[model samples]
Target chain A: MTEKIARFFAENRPATPCLVVDLDVVARNYDRLSGALPDAKIYYAVKANPAPEILRLLTGLGSSFDTASVPEIEDCLAAGATPDRISYGNTIKKAADIRRAYELGVRLFAFDSEAELEKIAANAPGSRVFCRILTSGEGADWPLSRKFGCDPEMARDLLLRAAALDVVPYGVSFHVGSQQRDLAQWDAALSTTAAIFRDLEEKGVALRMVNMGGGFPTRYRTDVPGTDEYGFAIDEALRRHFGNRIPETIVEPGRGMVGDAGIIQSEVVLISRKSANDLRRWVYLDIGKFGGLAETMDEAIQYPIETERDGGPAEPVILAGPTCDSADVLYERAEYRLPVDLRIGDRVAIRATGAYTTSYSAVNFNGFAPLQAYYI
Target chain B: MTEKIARFFAENRPATPCLVVDLDVVARNYDRLSGALPDAKIYYAVKANPAPEILRLLTGLGSSFDTASVPEIEDCLAAGATPDRISYGNTIKKAADIRRAYELGVRLFAFDSEAELEKIAANAPGSRVFCRILTSGEGADWPLSRKFGCDPEMARDLLLRAAALDVVPYGVSFHVGSQQRDLAQWDAALSTTAAIFRDLEEKGVALRMVNMGGGFPTRYRTDVPGTDEYGFAIDEALRRHFGNRIPETIVEPGRGMVGDAGIIQSEVVLISRKSANDLRRWVYLDIGKFGGLAETMDEAIQYPIETERDGGPAEPVILAGPTCDSADVLYERAEYRLPVDLRIGDRVAIRATGAYTTSYSAVNFNGFAPLQAYYI
Candidate 1:
């Protein structure tokens, strides 16, 4: 845990099982990313963490937003972000919502299907539209399946349709999936975008933007490359594929921007053996899958943990949340080792949880308090 | 779908992806359970839904509540339930929360570990404490692992320790698991309770209560025995073991009480083929795993669905939620056959969702609205 985070929690003695975010760290992360990728426009994905404080902080730093819903757009706007800096990033949208977003001055939107395109054409006529292209999403910790994007052929057709319908065929966007690691994934994503760019050119529609959707990896359980390495690789990919013809690039960094800025301080509720013969210790925390730790689902994103007794001998433990649900177990399959001396009231700091923890908490499941986020 | 549920949505024209609960159905279910098991007191699990309206309705019907946390106790009290009518059912609780619940006048509590018992002893002295014993929770749709219960031997020792710590060893409890089927599972659970009862008797602690913990199955995809079957089996088990010396019985029914009382009306956001050549159509709904359908995790509970176009030819489809997460797909493994002609703007009514849907919603995940619940 960062000294600043530990000091905040230790001094305030704020409620246990709460998230503490440092705005100083967030600003530093933002500066680091912008400094590395000077040319790429930053659109912070609001879904990662929709706290108004974070939004206002990012907005003050002149970061644009990639929103998934109208509420997010409203949140950004409430934080003094102009509507022009917001883009509706979710491909699946209710038609009514599309009209609502359009009325709210959201001109840029993303869609991956023909039906969505028609809905956009009907609701937000003359607005800018981008089609998300499908990628295998390999080499990412949280590899996305074929849930959001379409094929290159479909993208070309959709772009043409967007242009013909009087909506500006703004660009093509593709997510390498959240927490993307290997830089080679960018090569495939960029190559696919370049192919669609050539196809769109053949059909007499010039795409003006390339949205390299958020997937930039954050430091978690596994080692990952830094922002500079990612920036270099992305710059190389753009040069190798589009040469000097690279369109206005947009990077939607969700976890990469804010994951390391926050720490969740959870209290140990109890520790016991699962059974008399079972040697493995079961460590139950006040916070579980429902208490703002849903990203621990399938252990796809493992947050580094820190406790006061970290130097003691480590013991493999089955960690669980406080909910009565059986599936609330966090680290059973992907084993977690913690200090054996940890006891009740001992704080365990879940590091780098700033992005998804607060937003994804289940709304008072089992009557547990919604995660209280404290920004320092 | 019930006519009342369908009519409410049709007439109200509420926004897409909302939960509609019929209090009349809830009252009837409550009456049926109470009517069948006259000897057992009903404690409606607030964690199942925790909707104030539902709690008030249950309170109006003279039903006690089984709360899991301090907030739940407050919700129950706000709904006009007396503190004596509430039991803290969660085995894992923070010490501070235990004190808070005690200060709120909640005396009846459940614990499965010594740590929790000690916390209760220290915070809520002389409180009525129940120790939960372990069971495999076999043959249940949502089979619970060894997350909430202690082994019988440990439970016996814990009860003694509770008495030593000046807490009343008021009862013994055991859950067969949520949505538990196989009436034989109850036989095993009850027999284990009988053995523990005998052992406690030998140790000079005559238990005053027997909490044949909730696991009464709710009708979902699979056909389940009615309340009468459960009541009959439990009555027979008590007769065979304790005869005229039976203790006060308590049934903490969460899903069983309210599952059949509600239906969720979600709009079909989009319908598209997974790929150009993929045979299955993916039907995306406005409400998904994050949007109050977390019970569908890993296809553990399959909710029966109805659409307005139900008369059309059926086709196997992959059901998904509208969130950007790939894991938000609801029923990819358990294929759902829906109307072939189902289109966007159409409504899908998910049946028997009252118990788990409303309370388990993600707090504004992906900027989608939390599941709005309407009570009739």
Candidate 2:
């Protein structure tokens, strides 16, 4: 367990099943990434954790934002971020929302389809637009499906269309995937990105920026290299692929930037044996899939969990969240081991949960309160 | 589209991606169930759609509640329901929450483990307590996992232990499953329930009630029986199992009680071909899994969808929610056919969504607003 988590519990005595984000850890995580990739501009994806305190801290550190909707843009602005520093990154948005973003002085946007492009042209005229090329979401913890970007050929046509429609064709972006583990995936995505740049150039549209979308990895149940290693590999790939023609680059890091800064303390509600002969114990927690742990779906991103019990023989236990719904199980197939002597009221600390917990939690499933977040 | 949905859009012009609940339909549904199951007590499961308006409507119909938490009990009370009319039905609850419920004058509770039984014994003396026995969760649209109940032997011990601790052992309960389709599953579950009753009688503890947990089905993509069929089958099963020794019976219906009463109207954001050669179209809607359609997970509970366009050739399209996250895809593998002429800004009506939509929505993921609920 991280010292910040232990200290927070020791000092604050906050409610169980609550998320605690240590600002000191967040600042340190930000510093590590910024120091390693000194040249690459960082746009913190506001959707990851849109808590006002997190936005304010990132904004104080001179970080720009990658906003998904108008409310996100408003949130960043409320946290003291200027509209110029925010890019409307979501490809699927309503025309009215686009017009509102433009009215709020936001200029940069991203689109992957003809309808969205037309809407953007009609609503946010003369805005800097980025056309995303689809990337194979291989080897990422949360592999995104074919939902965000278009193929390279379609991307070329869309960028050219953007230029003709009075919107500036500013950049090309592609997310390898969220919580992407394999660095080679970035190499492949960057190659596709380079091909998009070439095809746009052949069409007589010169792009000014290349957005390296938010697929940067976080350390979660896997051997992920530190930020420096990711920085070195990303820097080497850009140098190899783009050579001297590299455009102004931007990197959006959602989980990698904020994940390690937060930890969740959940209370154990019950530990019952399924049957007389059942081997594994069922451990129920006060928090669950609906209570801000939705990322635990399909066991894709297993948050490292630690309980207060120690010096006891351990056994595999199926962990679950406190909900009447049947699908609220969190760790059943995934091999989660806990102390056999662990009893009700014991707290389990889930590490690296800062990015997606509160943002993804259901409003009030089963009449349980939303996951309360605390910042230290 | 249903006449209620069309009338809602025509007269109210409610916001897109919003859930519109017709109180008239809800009243009809309540009347049908209460009229059919005149002998069985109906406790409206508050987690289904905890809107105050719906609560008031149900309360006016003289419906009691099956609440999962303290806030749900409070919601029922605020809607003019008396404290004695609410049952604390969640198997997993905190000790403080149990005490608070007792303080609120809630007498009926459910438990599945020794720890929880002890908690209830300490918190609420002489309260009506029920023990849940595990069920197979087979043949249900939304099958529950092994999270809430204990084995028959364990349950027998728990009820006896409750009697010893001065807590009233009110009865035994078991859920066939949520959205349970096959009536045979109830037969098997009732057989198990009878065995538990026999076991409790052998221990000299006469139970006063039999809580038949909610699994009543709603008509979605698949056909479900009317309330009369379910009522007749349940009555036959109880008569066959317990004969004249049957106790006061309770039925808690969440989805079955309210699913068909509400419809969600969502706007199509974009319809794009994934590739030039790809046959299936990708249709993006303004509301998605995060926006309260979370029941779409794994395509388990399929809500019948209708669009504005007709008289056109139908094509299979992968339906997705409008979010940056790729997991928001609703039905990629499942067959969902839409009119080929469907365009952006076209509205689609998701029928029978009153139960799980608004209560299951994320607060604001990716800056998208929570699914707004409008009462008609």
Candidate 3:
């Protein structure tokens, strides 16, 4: 955890199962990402963590926003972001929502299908549009499905169709995956994007932009390459693909922008074994899948856990949330070792949980309140 | 769909992505369950759909409650349920919560371990407690894990130990599974509970109650046995296990109690294919896994879907929610079919969603509001 969060926890002693985000860490991450991609515009994905403080900070830093809905766009505008700096990023949207975004003077939008393109054409007239193409989502901790994007050929056809639909065919976009570890994945996605650009260009429809959707890695239980390495690899890939005629680039980083800036402080409610001879202890915590750690749905995105009783003998335990549902178990198959001296009411800090935790929390499942969040 | 919900939708023309629950259906289901099991107390599981209206109706019907948390207990009390009529049902709970329940005059609790039993004894002295034993969760559409229960031997030891800890050893509880289809599964679980009861009686600690936890099935896309079949099987099991001296029994029904009482009305947001040659259409709806239908996590619960254009030719479609997250896709492998003429803005009614939908909704994942509900 960051020193700011640690000192805040030490002084305030906030209630358990609360998220503490160090704003300084978020600012540092922003600066690091900007320094690495000096030419690309950073559209901070608002769905990750839309704390007003973080939004205001990013707005002050001259960052653009990638919003998933009309309310998110309004959030960005309320945080002092100009309408020109917001991009409506979700592929699936209602026509009413499209009209709302257009009325708000947001000009950039993302779409992957003809129906969505037609809706945008009719609702948000003269807006710039980007077509999202499919990626294999290989080599990432959280791989995306084919829900958001279309085939490269479909993207080309949609972008070409946009030329006649009163909207500008701005660019093409693709997401490798969330928490992408392999730098080569970007090159693979960019190659398909370049081919689409070339295919559209030959038909006299020139695309001027390349939206490299968010897939930047963040530290979890394992090490990942630094921002400099990612920047170097992306620079090399751009050179190989565009050959000095590179398009105006945009990178939307959600998890990489704010994931490591926060920690979840939970307390051990109970710890016991099922049988006398059972070797594994079941450790139940105040927060669970419905509370904020929804990323642990399939035991994916294992957060590094630390206890105050560290440096003592430890054993593998079945970690679970304080809920009645059986699916609330967080890490059963994964080896989660905890200190044997851990007792009820002892605090456990879950690391690198800033991005998806609070946003994914259930409203009042089992009568548990949503995860309490504090921006330091 | 129930005639009441369909009429309400037609008349109100409520906004898309809303839930409409027919209280009459819930009342009828409760009466049927009571008629099937004439002697057992119905402890309505509050985690299913804890609407104040439903709770008040059940309270008027003289139903007890099986609450999962302190807030749920407060909800039950607010709905006019007496403290004696509510049971703390979650096995994993904080000591502070136990004390709070005690202060609120709650005297009955559930536990599966010695640590939890001690917490109950210290926090709520002289209270009655039930031990939960592990069941194999077979023949269940939504099978539970071993997260909440202990072995039968372990349960006997804990209940025996509770006799000396100032807490009464009330009985044993076991869940066959959620949406359980096999009537024989109850017989198997009761066999385990019977052996535990016999062993405890031999050791001079005679248990007085048998808390048969909820596993009653509800109709979804397919037909399930009526409540009478379950009642007959449970009655036979009780007779075979305890002869004529059947203990005071309790049944906790969550999904089965209210699953069929509500329907989620959602609008089709977008429809498209990955490519020109793609055979399956992708259907996007305004409400998704995060919006309320969280039981679709692994496609474990398939809610029956209906549309206005159902009579036409239909083809298999990949269903997804209106979110940027790839995991929001509802059914990709499941053979969900939609009418070929289904258009954007057409209404789709998701059946058997009254229990888990609104309760499992995310606070606001993608800037979308929580699932709105109307109880008539």
Candidate 4:
């Protein structure tokens, strides 16, 4: 889609290097994801964009929270999300963090290893546990094949071990990986999960909540689905997997929830020649791969950077970050056409960067100013 | 080189997740580069590791400072590098930042575009400018080439423009990109710079410095040179470019100075399996891309991640991050056989991360805590 990014830029608060959150886009995203997984529960991943305003928007959209650490849990709590409505998805927790989360009444916790099971048993004594069965896919952005998923054989055995330790295994939770472009991977992985569930049922293991976790797609381009956005396949999978029997599917989409909602409204800092005598020069904006690609050096979930004039056709130019690092690329090479005569301080917005753009990326390694936040 | 990285874990400071800056290595780096370019000044690029301790060490080792922005300028100034010794490398600057630097008496500055020249002329008319000629090479781990650099042909014109604007073109500066591995590219680019300097000198553009800006190599490996133990091509290039030249030949080595000086020492938190039957399980660590590979994600700078326990022969394992984001990877299929039975809270130190780890990475992303800083 030919997005009017400049207009979105112009409509932001008076912070040059600020992150702009589009409430309307976020609401639409919530509705779309909630509708697609009608039987499932949607927990907005707070880590993506944990600005107080964004959290409030997620709360208003009738979504729960998927918090990882204590700060996330605290942020959700401060944002008025109840303890029961939040699940600590990052199952590996510090001893202090675990006790604090347990104290805060966070029930649903994800676990991948036997050591973690024992820690959970010792910490809370009887906290509700969700064994995180990490999934694998061929085209997965972050292949979950190694992260936190227990092998199906080991997972079953671990479940028995946890049961013996008085650690209640709520259900199985597996992420097909973030930004999953291929939908069939989800189908096959879910089929594998389903088999595990059936085996657990036969063995009389408490198999209750099958968290066909969140990796649902959000369209970055009109032509294809992003790494996270599975397009129609995920919706169809939801329909096929639980045709008659409904399961409590918990999805924590860090990028999908606020990815489209946020945009980095920045100025054209330096417009200079990329090479000697190249036809066009680059439009260096205040935000670079370090800022807009805050959570990512590679995976930037944004609509292409396109600028507009008052009454002229849009021109796309290669937009980049302020860092001197060459790898600090924002929009890929010549992907976006921008106004050729773009001057310094000319405002442009990098759309769909609301998620994982600000909080996730604030180290200021180059000692540049940290990104200020604003909500629209 | 078989680097004993376990020493970093036992460095006796900070929490499980911490950055250990080995002062000894940093001093040697500063000494080697300074000794090689004895006649020309060496500006320690503050963007590499802006931590106060790192800055103190570099400044203590008799190196000038190269700053990109105001905070960096302030950092250099605070480190007592003096404004005259600090060169504002960022060509794009607002009137305020320029005025601040000029007021602080920053001696040298760079401008890539004519617009920036005009602005510099209007704001800091008395300041001398460096005509940054764009060099062609693509292997910068942190590529600054994409943003900075003017066409050599147009740069010739810009040199004349500087003459007209009364901004002294004290020297010509061109970077061969960061993490530049190709020595031949430097040879060609410096030869091109020398040619441009000669042409400019023929055109009555007198110069005092030919800033062969730093992209010197430094890694955990010994065969590549410029690692912890040996100096790389810094002296060879100086000999070729400025042999017996009366003018100062400048080199601003950020990564080269500290890339091997610091190591990201983190403790393993948990290890989990992907599927029930999968033999592989993930070992999650306290430090992640946010703290280490925060800036360079897609083309992440590969470092040697080693465990501290010196037991039997080393074995390689996939170390994952604590963040829930799948793309948050610490290593790409890294293998270092230190110990087979690595457990939770086992310390792992990632060498060659000193340059960008603390400087570019942010804390509070994904609600994870930031790495505590410690220096020897």
Identify the leading candidate in terms of DockQ.
3
Estimate, for each residue in A246-357, the C-alpha lDDT of model 3 and write its tens digit: 9999999989999999999999999999999999999999999999999998887989999999999999999999989988999999999999999988999999999999
Assess candidate 3 and give its TM-score to the true structure.
0.99
Could you give candidate 2's per-residue lDDT for residues A338-365 as a string of tens digits?
9989988888889889988998988888
The digit string of per-residue lDDT tens for model 1 on B285-308 reads: 999999999989888899999987
Report fnat for all candidates as fractions from 0 to 1.
0.59, 0.71, 0.90, 0.65
Each prediction's TM-score versus the true structure:
0.96, 0.97, 0.99, 0.88
Answer with 1 or 3, whichever has the higher lDDT. Answer: 3
Q: Rate the local accuracy (lDDT) of all candidates.
A: 0.87, 0.87, 0.93, 0.69
Chain B TM-scores, listed for every candidate in order, come to 0.97, 0.98, 0.99, 0.88
Candidate 1 vs candidate 2: the DockQ winner is 2
The residue ranges of model 3 lying beyond 4 angstroms of the native Cα positions read: none
**Cα misplacement distance, residue A368 of candidate 3 (Å):** 0.4
Pairs in clash, predicted candidate 3: none
Q: Which lDDT tens digits does candidate 3 get at residues B81-143?
A: 999999999998899999999999999999999999999999999999999999999899885
Worst 10 residues of 1 chain A by lDDT: A272-281
Please write out the lDDT profile of model 4 over residues A105-215, one tens digit for every residue: 887777877888877887767767877665664655434435556667667777777778866877777777666667787777666666666777787885667776766
Model 4 chain B scores worst on lDDT over the 10 consecutive residues at B223-232
- Highest TM-score scorer: 3
Q: Between candidates 1 and 3, which one is better according to DockQ? A: 3
Error of 4 at A135 (Å): 3.8
